[model samples]
Target chain A: DVKVTQSSRYLVKRTGEKVFLECVQDMDHENMFWYRQDPGLGLRLIYFSYDVKMKEKGDIPEGYSVSREKKERFSLILESASTNQTSMYLCASSSVPSYNSPLHFGNGTRLTVT
Target chain B: QKEVEQDPGPLSVPEGAIVSLNCTYSNSAFQYFMWYRQYSRKGPELLMYTYSSGNKEDGRFTAQVDKSSKYISLFIRDSQPSDSATYLCASFTSGTYKYIFGTGTRLKVLA
Candidate 1:
């Protein structure tokens, strides 16, 4: 049923503030991602958008920055938030398969950059 | 090093046991292999989706891909407690669309 929605699920922000994480995918999928899941350092890939205004910079895009004007929305910008940018923040969407087609997540956003 | 090598396991099984999860890769141009199931803060739930190598079941999960021993496996039969959580192992590298995980393995299927 492909449904990825995330606007917030517990965020607190403080140090340097300015964090906006939002992702919406109703299956218009063209490829959209932004991940940051720490703990032995795992899901690192901080920006990806392959359409509407395209953008790319995975592998920990420092300080983070992304926004895909449209196409089911995908935004993740932290510009300043510190505290190591807190943790848990995922948003994925993929379609245009040819193999590696396994990414349809959302339901995360546990930022707490105090 | 660290193209994908998972062993963050908290591994602890009981209920019906028989759960083996692993991952190892140095990137032999990873064909495409996946296994995700995270449920502790949520955001990963696409268990098993293979390509290029071998097995792929979906009743109790079973995904094994061995590109000449690049190694990868995920088997969970009978295990319950909702099968605990965290078990990621992903790969994808050809023209690069990005899909490389594996730093997760925290299963605890007690009962």
Candidate 2:
């Protein structure tokens, strides 16, 4: 069984404050993804990293950034958090054989920006 | 129209009843189908996956995909309260990182 650990379960931040959400996967998967799950919008991708020091923007990438200094760890950064940025963030990882493999996801980090 | 569509159902059913959840996709390029279960305040956990138009069963859950109709389904047998959660379906084409996910359907198995 693969374990994906998130740094926080609940986060509260003030508007204009910088915030960071961290995630780590035990399995040596090559691909890591960050997504925000909203009420009606469903799960929208934020950023993804395919390799160390590499990153790509997803559908909703505004007001967000990512860092993947290591293969096992992926971090999402908010330069200036806003109330609208408050949502549940999810991290997932998959290996190169993504065809048959499903993305193993972490529990999640729920953020509340005021 | 959305690429993938799922009913935002708060389907309520009694325990030990069979539960059916489904989704439909508009893109014919989608070749892989996946089902995920998400509890409140949690990330989605993959429940099942199918390569194409076929039925795959695992324990109490079965996933079916019909490429001709662009439809996918997940059936849960003898539902338990533990099965109460949101079910989401996803589809993606081969050799691509882009995956389209349905809006998700919420289910409650009453005791």
Candidate 3:
């Protein structure tokens, strides 16, 4: 079974603090994604990386950035956390761009910014 | 209009009752439709996947797609308490890794 592991299950940070969410997948997938799930807004993509050192901005990338330093690991960074940035962050991995390949997701990291 | 639209329903049903979930999309380029189920404090898990249009069944779950209407449906027969969760509908354009997801419908199957 493929496993996507999130480093932290719960986190609390103060405003203006920097936050880091780590994700590691054992599936050896080439594509990794960071998404923020909000109530009534669904899962909005924050950023994605198709290869190491390569990243693309998604719809809601303003308050977030990502890094893929090595295969099997992806990281989401919040430069300055704010109250509005409080939400559940999810990490997912996929093999490639194909109809048959679906994303394998991590359990998620719930971040609360005060 | 949003690319994908789903009623953010907290639909409640008794155990053994039939449950229906639906989603509509405005993008005609979307050829692949998928349903994901997310439990409390957990990430969304892919449940059913359909390409183009038609019906597919797995156990007590049935997925239906209608390209002409740009609509999709998921039906759960004899719903159980364990079926309570948030159901998300997503659409993918061919050749793209990005997927647009719906707001999700929250279902509670009471015992």
Best by TM-score: 2
lDDT of 3 by residue, B1-111 (tens): 999999998999999999999999999999888999999999998899889999999999999999999999999999999999999999988777788999999999999
> Hey, what RMSD does candidate 2 come out at?
1.0
The predicted structure with the larger DockQ, 1 or 2, is 2
> Candidate 2 residues A4-54, lDDT tens each?
999999999999999999999999988899999998999899998889999
Of the two candidates 1 and 2, the one with more favorable TM-score, higher being better, is: 2
Q: How displaced is residue B42 in candidate 3, in Å? A: 1.1
lDDT of each: 0.88, 0.93, 0.92
Q: What is the TM-score of chain A in candidate 2?
A: 0.97
Tens-place lDDT per residue, model 1, A1-114, is 899999889999899978889899998888888888989988888889888889989878988888899989999989889998889998999886576467889988999988
Residue range B9-77, candidate 1, lDDT tens digits: 799989998899989898788888888898888889887788878898989888999899899999999
Candidate 2: Cα lDDT at B87: 97
Residue runs of model 3 more than 4 Å from their true location after superposition: none
Model 3 lDDT, full chain set: 0.92
Residue lDDT tens for model 3, A1-114: 779999999999999999999999998898999999988778999999998999999999997888899998999999999999999999999888776767778999999999
Q: In candidate 2, what are the lDDT values of residues B1-111, reduced to their tens digit? A: 999999999999999999999999999988889999999988889999899899999999999999999889999999999999999999988767777899899999999
DockQ agreement of candidate 3 with the native complex: 0.78
